[model samples]
Target: MKEIIAIIVFCLALIKGEINSEILIVSENNCHQVFDKDQGQITSLGYPTFSSSNSSCTYVIKAKKGQVISLQWKDFNLPAGHDRLCHGSSDSVVVYDGRQIGINNLYTPMCGNHSFDITSSGNMMTVVLSSTSDEFDIMSFYRGFKAAYKSMSHHCKNMIYKTGYGAIASPHFPMAYPANLDCVYTIKLNQDRVMLLEFAEFALKPVKGNNNKMAMDDCDDYVEVYEGAISQRNRYFRHCGYYKPHPITTGGNIVHIKLHSAKSQLALYTGFRAFYYSGVPNKCGLFYGTPSGALTIPVIPQTSGINVECQFTIKSPQVAYYRVRWLSFGQDLFKKGCDENNYIEIYNGFYDKKDKLLAKKCDTKLDEFDTQYNEMLVRFKIEKFNPSRNFKFIYIGVTNNTVKVITDKNQTCTAKTTIVYRYSGPEVISREVKCELFSIGGLPFWASLLIVCGAGGGGLGAISVAFCLIRRRIRARRRYRRFERSDSEGSL
Candidate 1:
């Protein structure tokens, strides 16, 4: 319950701050650079526009100790001729989990056009862009890739990662985890996909009794793995030993991991390290709200999932105003504000004419927006997937009488309200996000209880019809099951 509260606290935070009106493009000389700062952006030569062929760049970011790095590819584009399979593509952008590039560090080598997010296990992350003569086309152009990096000091407790595959560890691995620490890592994937986990290292405070005897069921520090929505009965296994466990596999789309430590052996046990990957993926046109969450359009390794078109309608409660927040961005091109290609629109009251435009933007700076009525229709578009998610918008239920913060800096937003792109792919994303910014005070935190949970959202209000769900973690000392042995560890 405490973890649930912490995650929602940010969703209710007042969206009050000055909005920056420009997009800063880094210079070409900044390539092959090493950053030890807390946050920054890396771009390939010319950004927000195409550059000459054969231009490549690389960047490495290192965070402070006890911290990890998070990345979001806001813009990623390549010439048409370079669109080939991962192994066959001549022009590619690769991301590594560590400071250097190698087979073990390779996360993904993207060739065509794609946008997504990544989180590093330790303190460093690497990005490299390369192209050859086969990719150079006198008649074609490419924008390369742009990404934002920030230091993540939180060990990702109660954080929801919908990117499908990534690495997770106790707050700061290799170093001893602090005492009385509790955290949860959740991986949500498409229902069709299964997941697997292989622990590279594992250690827990030993509960050695007389003669240095260890008990398997009895533990001081431990890790718990769950199959679905982290309920006591849904637990797959619990471990409190020091040896690396066998690879864990799950039969469902979502997996939950919980970690706990006592104060007795803070300096002795270094905790555990593990990597998780899944085979499934998108939430489009979906009407649901998990306090504050992002729009997750999974990167389906196939050619079909790369192209996207999504729409949503966020509405406020009877007497509240609808709101949206940002968790990431690619490039909000200030110079070429909202265009027919990429944009976002928020409306209050009637949709046809009486609607008030609360916010409007292009691939430029999007902070937060609230409506003048009890509901708002939100429309976000990108003629092509921008390679980085725009911003994770949250519905902060603000009172209707409060001072309005958003305004319609109208620039022909109405002129291009309806657009038809020249591509076809993710058509199922025509969801209506009608549950955000509304009062969900009575709703439970676990998504399993919300009706939209099936469609990848935790909702309230109308969703409260769903009473108590089967899946729930009661306390810090959640009930769990034990795996028999390493070789026999199995999926739920």
Candidate 2:
């Protein structure tokens, strides 16, 4: 009879799908997911309801460190053929594990639909989205250009590039050139030569190159056509140089400059303006630039504790390439692990300089940057600077407005940039004034005060509290010891 009963129980266990499990997790709705610890196979857990509504319920789990967690849900509801409730069906819950860090779904995965796995397995313990596109995160990639371009170009016969920031709706709006320069222009990468250029009131004839060639007047406006290898002496400049030069030609249009990086890291930067010899100051300190003919714009001192920011419009008719490089001079300035390269090279979006051909690259996303250092040089270049086909550079990554370039990056660092004109034309070069890092946390003042106060009141309040707690603990321990001794003696 006992054997028969055991057999019946075994059959019931099989019917209920109850197998010995290994790992467990508490779900947002208090449902439990069971799987083998070794194999990581989900034995049984019915369909999960993914909620995106802000006021959805939460589930709590009691677990230890080093446990793997996952969520199961879908992006859409009713399999695409059902009803009027399709709007809020894709909202999901993102679980933040208190202990070990790993991927957590912002929403549950759709049935049978894969690839939306957002993993975050870092010690930082932050539930940062690893999957699903983050348009804002791309901006951080461009901070590498903090040491490249200097100031506005003095040969501003017709073109001006200025940095502007604030709350704005569209990516291309809110862009304004420096007020000091006369002619202001916006370059867009488009199929039809649609570019914009305004003539400065005080137009000066450009100095001729040594070849006695007209050195290309109004050439700065057509940076899209100049197709050649791009290079810069400043290693930390943000703009990545291209092996092939691209000049501008299309007028009233924006251009895209995509860089390819295969093996070595690429530093990309872009800015406007070039400083002349008269404005260049004789070198006095590492942080100061020489006087060049161009007026020196005083470098802004970083106001610590506040977020400093700058937003520029990247009106490329096509997709554009962006890169950033920075010079690290202060302590704690080294790249986390790489000692060989003094500067950090970060590619903001898609495209690598290492590719054998530019055709192999594609734009994954578009975004802008924020300044991150106390002082930095900036250099910005598109495929070309103009509308006439005489210059060469690809304004658009593929075609025109079908794609767009945007800047979303900002910084709290001070900046002083100088543009070097190749002779007396708008063809100006760039560099930046170095800056020193200052602390605004008031930690030094507070630390000194703490030391002084403690020295004066040494062993006073702390000792008093310590003694009281210690006595109480000791009395309790003594009473327990005495009881134990009395019991042992009485037993004897």
Candidate 3:
């Protein structure tokens, strides 16, 4: 009972402090990022946004008692000339005036592309961005991430730009290159205080054939959205030396793309870029291919279950170790069985120097059905998970079935996987099942009389016992009176 009371008190305290751990991106005139509490509730101070050209942004994420609290800049922009004091004062009350956290001094120099990391105590987030190149100086901070940026070189100068998905390039630069380039950029969140997720390198390749076209929007020209720019129509088109496209948001993540050429497979290569951030690193820039030559790969991030990326036919039963840069909690890789209906799970120990491996028991059979209803999807929820920990599931042999669960580790697992089974069948019919127990029959007033008579008889028995006691007492009294009268007569 006392523990329950403590938990309640703790939660109340957390809610009051405005501490939150969510990474929320809201679309507004001023592009805003809100870190919400666990229940999706916004704090009183509200979410934060870019205030001005020189304004800096400060984010406070913490859990007090038991509730998540978040406080950000609702007022004021980053104070110019005083870039060193961007995080605000120690006792600063959260508000929108010139007092809240502002954008760092890098807005004008670096074009507002700033990144940093800090511990819960605020002692670790002490990095100053004074110049344009300093923003990219974070390469050392993100040691585990792939550290390359893709751009169209001068070699490609005269090719028609085709808007598609994934990476699609031409022999030369896009004749409509300004309209076709789209790229995806991913930022990995490192919550582990000790070990940080490192990015080695990433490669950008051109999508083959018509696959790239499908990734573009319905419009003939492709438009990109980025940080300051939220929408396609409102985007500021910049094509100075290299065409810098905007980023897109889908399924609650940010993506950037560029369609530089119509036919040349120009790829951006970034070596190992590693760093530690607040959340897990699951986001990546995806270049889509056209529908005619679509990659048809699973687009969801793996949070749990089995994610299998393998070839169907293999002669030798060879065992080769697959190493993902890192796997925090709620993420795993799996192999597909006969088709997408079956899978095998795998995980490598993140902490063990020896790298101990464990595999979860297999699911013998999975029901295959496809529909547009809620119950048709499989949901997996993991709460209070650390990304550094790894768990594994075994696959007896390889088949053609596989599935992946993609969700944030810190948030409740609640990651749902919906399987689409393609088959020709009759339309499903709905029917109701009903059960009737027993019915009552009408009784006459005689039944009521019987109940009343039984109650009356019980009352009479009680009254009879009382009357007998009274009579006995009266008889005794009369005997005593007679004895007294006789005694008086004798005396006379």
Candidate 4:
């Protein structure tokens, strides 16, 4: 009687189609399916049995509202697809978000031994499998894949790319992307190479006035590119309302790209596609804003006898002026003339040689420079391949709109900078001018000035009371000050 009961149980298992792993995912006759079970197994046609050749099917998985579908592969084994053969001779599988199966909707194609988790952006996802080649004697040859799906929730995280080359597109390229996206992707290269980016397709929300400015004042649905991390200091490029953008080459090894769609963006639009690669970086750039950190110019490889020169321009908006502080300069440049072959030329305004000269300096050990103007140009020319040009600087922005003027005759600054460098009698660039660059509250410069004045030379009354004591020190220091201000050749 016990043996009879055991035989009956075995027959019942076979009758229910519980073979292989004992859980039938899809029946043999029904390949196309809509999976409504919250969590269940999904597999290829006749999974764990055999997948017929040249056969294909699609499976749509839907989760509850406000929840996304998540898929994880347990087993995946299929004939490899050859890219060189144009996918004609092998079998493959594709997983994508939403119900559509178009060019832009695909995740990376899956074949030999790949198991990963894919979470949809919405509540629906589709998976498709196709078999095209029959290399074996019979059509029913290999067992295919096994995966599980369930409802889940997700959040967006910042992406960092370390690959040497790759392509990145907005959520669903060529199709209207979802609303209210805020994503940041960064590409970091090795020390020897810098990042180069080119945008193939770009169409953000249009500007209100139909302006075509690359550096837009007001941008909503926009893209921003920075040479470093996303911060007020590294922001140099921001664009909106354009079809395509010019290629960008970074001065350093890291590049950060940010894509933002405002909460007000109710409608959807096809976003953008960009490609990036790492390569040898040559010099030249447009640097904006105040830097909280120091920047070093990276070196490029060249033959022995070549002289490579590069120039970069720094500019501020109309409301601010530049405050430059060279960390290791005043001590190195105190008594020496700049080198002729490998020297830096500083111009008063934006134009390099067309504007009046500020200083043809070789070294500026540690000093403060307030360019009471809105723009400045810097040119670095060095002969032969030196690993470093020994140039480092911190460009800053001060929220002031006026140029400092003691007298109309002493410091005559205009569209072209004019300085009274000629010693008509005993006139010199005074320490009082240096104080003007660093008078902010609790600043390092102000704190250092306090320490210097509060010591023995408390000939007090500064900025108010100590202001007179500061003048006495300026009179004592000017006798030995370098006459760099007078060296400019008037107007260029």
Cα-based TM-score, every candidate: 0.44, 0.18, 0.19, 0.40
- Candidate 3 C-alpha lDDT tens digits along 397-458: 11111122223222212333322211111112333333332222334455544454457558
Across residues 282-347, which tens digit of lDDT does each residue of candidate 1 receive? Answer: 434233321112343433343232445556554433223545554345553233666775666666
Best by TM-score: 1
Candidate 2 lDDT by residue in tens digits, 1-492: 665664565445545754222212223443332222322222112222121222333232322233223322223221221222222323322334223333321222222222122211111111211112212221111100000111122222323222110000111111212222222232222222232221111122122334223333223211222111123311111111111121122211231222111232112212221110101111110121211101111122322222222211222211222222121122232214322222222222232233311121112112223222112232122121121101111222211111222223223244443322221222213434444333234346545445555566664567558879999999999999989998989862
- Measured by TM-score, how close is model 1 to the native structure? 0.44
lDDT-better candidate, 1 vs 4: 4
Clashes of each: 15, 137, 103, 15
* Model 3 alpha-carbon drift over 4 Å, by segment: 1-219, 223-492
Over 4 Å off in model 2, which ranges?
A: 1-115, 121-492
lDDT of each: 0.56, 0.24, 0.25, 0.58
Q: After superposition, how far is residue 244 of candidate 3 from its true place, in Å?
A: 18
Error of 1 at 73 (Å): 1.7
Q: In model 3, what lDDT does residue 446 have? A: 54
Q: Ranking under TM-score, best-scoring first?
A: 1, 4, 3, 2
lDDT preference between candidates 1 and 2, better one: 1
